[model samples]
Target: MVLDTVMTTLHVLTGALWVGSVVFVAGVVLPAALDGSLDAAPLETFADRLVYGSRAASVVMFLTGGHMAGTGYTFDLLLNSSRGHLVLAMLLLWLVLSALVEIGRSRLVEGLQEKRVRSPARNAMGVFRAAAVVGVLLLVDAGLLASDVALY
Candidate 1:
C-alpha cells in the first residue's frame, strides 16, 4: 500500500509537470517566439530550454509509469485497469510531444536558419498549441483515472 501510494504520487507529479511544461511551451514560449525577433542564437536558446525541460519531465513520467507497470499487476490487469486508460492518455500526450519536438522544433530551427519569422514560427506555435490542448485533456483524464480504480 505504501509503495503504491508513493508510485501514485510520483506518477501524478510527473503528469502534472509534463502537462505544465506543455502548457508553458505552447501558450507562453510559442507565442513569444512567434512575435519576437527571430535570431538564431535566441531561437536556439529558447528551443534548448524547452527541449531540456521536456526531456526531464518525460524521463520522470516514464520512470514512474514503468514502476507501476513492474508491480504485481500483470500485463492483462494493467491493460484492463484504470491505469490502462491513463497509460493510453500518457502515450497520446507523449506522441504529440515527441512529434512537436521532432518536427516542430526542427522546423523552428529551419525557420531561424532561413529567417522566415512569421510562417515557421506561426506554424510551430500552432503545433504547440494543438499539442497543449490535447495534453491538457489527457492529463485531466489521468487525474480522473487516479481517483478511480476503474475508468472503464
Candidate 2:
C-alpha cells in the first residue's frame, strides 16, 4: 500500500510537471521568441532546460507508472476493462506528448544553433502547440481514470 501510494504520487507529480512545462513554453515563451521579444540566448537556455527537465520527468513517470501497473493490472484486465482503456489512452497520449516535446525542442535548438531565433521559434511552435493539446488530453484522461466518470 505504501509502495502504491508513493508510485501514484510520483506519477501524478511528474505528469503535471511534464505537461505544465510544455504548456508554458508553447503558450508563452515560444510566442515571445517568435515575435522577437525574446532573445536567442534565453530561448536556447529555456529549450535546453525544458528538454532536460522533461526527459527527467518522463523517466520518473515511466518508472512509477510501470510499478503501479505491473502490480495492479493484468493483460486480460487491460484489454477488457474501461479503466484499462483509459490507462491505455493515457499511455498513448504520454507517448505523443513526449515525442512532440522532443521534436519541438530539437527544432528550436537546431535553429538557435544556426543563430536564428524567430524562424526556429516559428518552426517549433506548431509542434509545441500539438504537445500542449496532447498534454491537456492526457490530463483529462487521468482525471477520468481518477474520478467516478464512466468511460463507457
Candidate 3:
C-alpha cells in the first residue's frame, strides 16, 4: 500500500512540474514578455533554469513508470484505476512533448543569450503556442480514453 502511494506521489509531482512550467510560459510569461522590453538575457537565463528542472521532472516520471508497471497492474484502467496503463501512456506522451518543448526553449534561450535574438519574444511565443496546442491535444486524448469509465 505504501509503495503504491509513494509511486503515485512521484508521478503526480513530476506531472505537476511539467504542467506548471508550460502554463507559466504559455499562459503568462510569454505573452507578457512579448509586449514588453524585458531584457532577453534575464528571460533566457530564467528559461534555461526552468527547462532543466522540468526536463528532470519528466525523467523521473518516466523512470517511475517502469516499476509501477511491474506490479502486474492491468493496463488502460486509466483514471478509473487512478494509476493505470492509460495514465502512464498519457504521461509518457506528455513527457516526450515536454522534452521537445524544453529543447526548443533551450535553443531559443541560447540564441537570445548569444545576442542572436532573431526576435526573442516572437520565437519564445512560438514555443509557447506549441505547448498550448499540445496541452489541448492531451486533454482531448484523455477525454476520449475516459469515455467508458464511470465517474461520480
All candidates' lDDT scores? 0.71, 0.89, 0.66
Checking candidate 3 for backbone clashes, the offending pairs are none
Going through the candidates in the order shown, the clash numbers are 0, 0, 0
- The top-ranked prediction according to TM-score is 2
Clashing pairs for model 2 are: none
Between prediction 2 and prediction 3, the one with superior TM-score is 2
For model 1, residues 39-140, the per-residue Cα lDDT tens digits are 556766777777776777677777777787677457786678766757666677776775676566776777776765666677787777776787788677
What TM-score do all the candidates reach, one by one?
Answer: 0.78, 0.95, 0.71
TM-score of 3: 0.71
Model 1 residue runs over 4 Å out of place are 1-6, 37-40, 149-152
Please provide, for model 3 over 35-141, each residue's C-alpha lDDT reduced to its tens digit, 9 standing for 90 to 100.
76456777777688777877787678677755666663554454356436456657666766675677668656865766654466677676666776675655554
Q: Which order, best to worst by lDDT?
A: 2, 1, 3
Q: Tell me each candidate's RMSD, in Å, in order.
A: 2.7, 1.4, 4.5
Q: In model 2, what is the error at residue 75, expressed in angstroms?
A: 1.1
- Looking at model 1, report the run of 10 residues with the lowest lDDT sum: 32-41
